[model samples]
Target: MGNKPLALTALSVALGLIAGCAANSSTTSKAAPADSGEKAAATAKISPNKPKNDYNITVNYELGMHCTGFDFTYCCVLPPYNSVQSQVIKTATGPKKYPELLEADEEDHSVVVDDDAGKRFKLSYGFVDNTYSEGSKLAYWNVPYDVDGDGKYEKNENVANAYWTHLYVYEGLKGANPKGTSKDSEKLFVGLQIPVPLDNGPAGAAVPSPMKGGHLHYSGEKGTIVYTKSPVLDNVPIVLTNPGIWDALGLPLTPFDDSLVRTNPLTLTEDLVRPFQETFVSLVDADSGKPVIDSHSGKPITFVGTSPIDVPNCSRCHSNETANGKKYTLYKQERA
Candidate 1:
């Protein structure tokens, strides 16, 4: 039995390597963004401009390839880029659509994409899908803008644009709040946003809760720029049981529940615990320090929070069967 287990573990590793290598071939062609311009200005403020139509800017998003692990747990795959994403920019003369160009390779873990405008700068988008939770995607986009127009996107640029964003769809929370019980529930999607700049901002900044409505403002000589997340007005009191908070909701169970008997009782406020349905994040144009918008849709370029409708069902390829005196069986795992 020990030998068999060892053999299986070796086989798992071998298979993982094979799959990862096969996927790697598809990843190397693309590139990640540079790092120079990632610093947030000492002074920036919150001011979002309306998206403009007929702005003539458009973004073309491309997804390269995927690599899988031996089990459902360790595979390195990225969620499909948002079904919708756009950005708008404001100039002294007028507002213009700053188109985005996204090229990502999940297998290689490399990404290169424009921040708020074309060729102004590119940001590296590093991401891995949250396998434990269905429809949950987490990634960080931060790097220097392409200031010299040389077509080389690197991080050494003086101005940096970087932040972390979390996106969650409604499917995973069905069991947590079935029937849309809460009056404040938007029944849409939710997200968490954090602005992490390399060489700017104060030390030890207070991180805001996604559930609680809050905005970040940085003021520079140019103007005030804002980063906003939707407010969670509808409160949901998630129960903390002795077994600990269940999955799906993934809420931080009250620390007071220190025993197996569930003796200590506590309820965390919705604002501090629950996430909002919709949130907004942006990389301001390095020049204007303002949020960019999509010219075609006239909205802040956004990404689709939902996963692609079509995902391969592993069970289809790994099924068990028994016929008369014969049995055909394969190991199985649940899909997110």
Candidate 2:
């Protein structure tokens, strides 16, 4: 797919909205100029879905992982365990079945990782895939907020409110490398994927692919704002004839994230939609100016990392929605 620029008129309107929102909103983790790297580590120390009144919402934006679920090869393959689908199926097969619909965790849920050398990677949240809802609505789950404090909720309380605003602070990487290389590997930043509803209607829309002139704001737990680096465009051709099988001869050996060298940044446009360009759900990197790629598979990687933040039980919260004549609260109480 080619990187097409958004219409000037459309972009102008979007930018105006983005600027207005960014200006008014406040983030807990405000970004610090020239200190994004340090702030990222600190940001990781906090929890995901922190208490709603903390005046901030934090969730992980998933990028394609190395040879894992929803990556080009593993696209749409749901795991049999801990997934919303499996739970539904289990409920049906087991004696303790929910007669109605179940509010389940979408495929490929987030987790925290501790790599060798004591490096902790917190990946607790992800974008909501379209599968969660019936009839093809592409919206990610937002950070839920009990706006009125009556304990009840409105759908709009989550991160969906921050889309297109300059104030919406995405998790940022200090030396972000979409191509698997970075200047500061220790403190990396990631941009949060804003859950903006794209109305592609009829035919499905393509995922955003970052190119020149794309810029988005990133913040850490400190809420420091920083301009994102240009994204590295994917050059390798994806061979889909055999679907699900990688063509060894057609592609280069997948490079490890630490092995790739840094490349020059691309000249970007003022198009606000440029930040929305992505390979799958991955955000454009601020340091390497490329879409984050998987280290082992070498495919364009969507941002995959988590925070320690604790969130509410979606199943419990969405219990009102019934399915197949039963309530959808099938999640185990302990986990919820």
Candidate 3:
């Protein structure tokens, strides 16, 4: 995918913003004359009457072990499981600079941060795109097998079902929705399938195949789903909380924190579908719930940032043979 170039571009843009902001905020001094030994005199600092605030958003992946290879039959066969976390920093510009950490307010359903001058302001964080709402039809690849007993493959239309499939297949975890056997509570069913062996490496060793045909059975936990294959663990009737499934998928557990204001564990697809996810942070007025405008820009004070993922391909350099048909060993003997 073109993720590398996109990540590089995003980095360049961030660096440019930092440089531009530093230039605008710092006091500039005139160049010193070469003939004289005197240094350039510092100009009088002009401080703002009130502290000017600026914000930055940092997003990063939760784990580095992201499955990037397309070969699903390999031993490390894992689907793209990319999850991201985000943090917001608020900085106030004044005689005494203040950097504050913003926190999510579950009660008010907003993020609050205090400036150096003790002025409190509300903020919000969210992804710009590539998010699915509840009950939205997922992509075919997300649930490629028939879920219902119908002859044809069941259409994967429910987000909750897709989430269950993802957990069972990729994470080896089971999930169930608290809602009864309704359309929204059903889980995706992956039909039993065998592994296809491949001998791409030397000595024709059997490669790892994808896991399939597992079902979710309750583990007796209140809000947990466990994967099971034994008949004893199968179909154990239990109440499953919808919030548990959502929480496992790195989704917001409460209605107050939807995609529009998800603070942490913002999950995204790692299949290069949308490797670069854009995030936005904006200052808001707590009482009015409106955006706080910047005096200089005459617009809402906001920061737009992009989180990029670059999964390294291990097979490229560690394979048995190179593209030029050269033999390679898994371990090379080091010379003293």
Clashes of each: 39, 55, 0
lDDT of each: 0.26, 0.23, 0.36
- TM-score of every model? 0.19, 0.17, 0.37
lDDT by residue for model 3 (283-336), tens: 666667677776655888766555453335534433424422555453444232
The best-first sequence of candidates by TM-score reads 3, 1, 2
Top lDDT: which candidate number? 3
Please write out the lDDT profile of model 1 over residues 1-336, one tens digit for every residue.
000111344543443342232232221232233564664334434343322332212222222123467787665644322211222212111222222123322221111223232433211111122111111121122324544346776543322222212222222211243455443233332222122222222110222211112122211122211222346534333211111110111111111111222221233222221111222333334344444565555565332221222234423323432112235332334334
Candidate 3: where is the Cα deviation over 4 Å?
1-53, 59-65, 68-84, 104-109, 115-122, 129-137, 140-274, 309-336
Q: For model 2, give the 10-residue run with minimal summed lDDT.
A: 82-91
Local accuracy of candidate 2 as per-residue lDDT tens digits, 134-252: 11211222346443346766644433332222212222212122454333332222112332222211101111211112122211122222233335632222211121110111000
Who is ahead in TM-score, 2 or 3? 3
Off-target runs (Cα >4 Å) in candidate 1 are: 1-118, 121-265, 269-283, 304-336
Candidate 3 TM-score versus the reference: 0.37
